[model samples]
Target chain A: MLGSEIPVFMTNRNTITEQYPKIYLYRRIVQAKLFIDANYADNIDLDNISDEAYFSKFHFIRLFKNIYGKTPHQYLIAVRIDRAMQLLKSDKPVSDTCYAVGFESLSSFSGLFKRIVGITPSIYLMQQQKIKAQIKSSPLTFVPGCFAEKNGWLKNRNFRETKS
Target chain B: MLTKMTHISINVLDQDSAFDFYTNKLGFKVVVDVPMGADGRWLTVSPPDQPGFEIILTPVIRSMYSKETSETLRELIVKGSFGVGIFTCKDIFATYEELKAKGVEFTKPPTKEFYGTEAIFKDDSGNWFSLAQLT
Candidate 1:
């Protein structure tokens, strides 16, 4: 035991014991992120998870966060919020938006919305409404044209398998 | 393909303290705290539930890294060179307070970011980490 008194949580790194091969589980972590995103609210217990990705809840959370800059919960929340944003733009009621985006309560949804978007749902909606009105009067589609260049990024990425 | 985060490395004076700060304090589980060689420990941690990612609680300054490179890393650690904080905490302030109570010293308290709340703190051996709550 050390002087400061926090015991070593796991000292023996036995190769044969409860351990997952690093590379094998690394791939599973990526898979876990995808699985969790596709089925966040679904029961994603470790045993039921497809790979080691879902094996440890805490382990998956760390891996996802380190790679993606957001935890699984945070990523899921962002997905929900993004959906809510679209709903709000289409004249959806705030409560409807909240529910449609998977929130059980509007208050919690609003709080999260403020935390991420730096404004309340009402304010964001109002701003979107004004922007839409201005766009409509200007004879221009309100949707911002994605400035995606005709870069070979997509081709390069997709063509990896075919490349020598 | 930058498909993997090789490992997050931290340089601290003592291995055990670094392990405690990351594991017991910050909620990371000891992924691998085995021996590097005869003299040094190769401590690592990942968010307990998340196994893919890892941070090497490396006493690199005291280990393989040369004195010159170690000094540069030490300077970066003090200057808060490692950008952004708050990885996957349920709450920012709560995590901050928990670390403070556990004797982790902060270079700066939680700062608001476009992404999330972040706090910079040093481990017992002067290595830095970002406690970021992503946006």
Candidate 2:
């Protein structure tokens, strides 16, 4: 009676579907990535991230690094630093941005920021602010020369002149 | 006589997501988007400026492949085993910045390679591509 309830075509497909397909592995890896993206601000580690995909820690590390070109730890640090950069650009204080982006201490945050970004967070913040002010003062100077020249607008204004 | 190659096939996990990634994210134009019964769609797209060459976004579907084979192929894809192709842009830094701002994940940022200035980024389905500006 239970068998008769299924359509003939559905019954045939169900036999194939019953196999534990390997093709679904990509979905699990992607799910793990999505988990990282959503939880990057939280204090997460290799074990926590790997468990999201149902893979063992070592295997997950290898698989993640192979696909993403970085270990899970490295990728997590990059994500945190990227978020910190954005926060600093928005005028967030250096100390605040450290904790905001999941870094535990200002000293470590500043040190790591310098290592990856080539400048301390405070200096980077100041640089962004300066660039923003410059852009506001002379917007045309920021436009690509090719774009300005193609539109024939360069004939009217010299970007080099505006900079001074 | 065979004149030139016109199409390249790419294995995508999902055709619909690949469509959005190729068109909206990469700015490619669609060449064909037609249903193919249960196997999925015959979807192909080309670079915005280069309209002649097409990249087929072939989906690995249950109807077309044995469950075991699909599993193997999907595992390969997620492992970043495929380097689909190289795309050229006029300004490597500018293009790199633009694509990054649009949520493209770059495994290696723009670095000066012997062939040219190159950067590598992965698509939505975990297939990596070399984005370069040749010298």
Summarize candidate 1's per-residue lDDT along B1-135 as a digit string, tens digits: 577664655555566766777765665755443332322554567885578777766564553457897688767765656552336665555455556655778876766655666677766655566777776
Query: TM-score of each candidate?
Result: 0.39, 0.47
- TM-score of model 1's chain A: 0.60
**Model 1 lDDT vs. the true structure?**
0.60
Tens digit of per-residue lDDT, candidate 2, span B52-133: 9989787765344678877888899989999988999865654565566569999977666556667889999899999987
User: Cα deviation in Å at residue A11, candidate 2?
Assistant: 33
What TM-score against the true chain A does chain A of each candidate get? 0.60, 0.74
Identify the candidate with maximal TM-score: 2
Per-residue CA lDDT of candidate 1, range A1-164, in tens? 47447433233212221122354454555565455545644434534553454456666667667655787677778767866776788778888888877788889999999998899999999987876565344311211122001211222322222332
The TM-score of candidate 2 is 0.47
iRMSD (1 decimal) for each model: 23.1, 23.8
Docking class of 1: incorrect
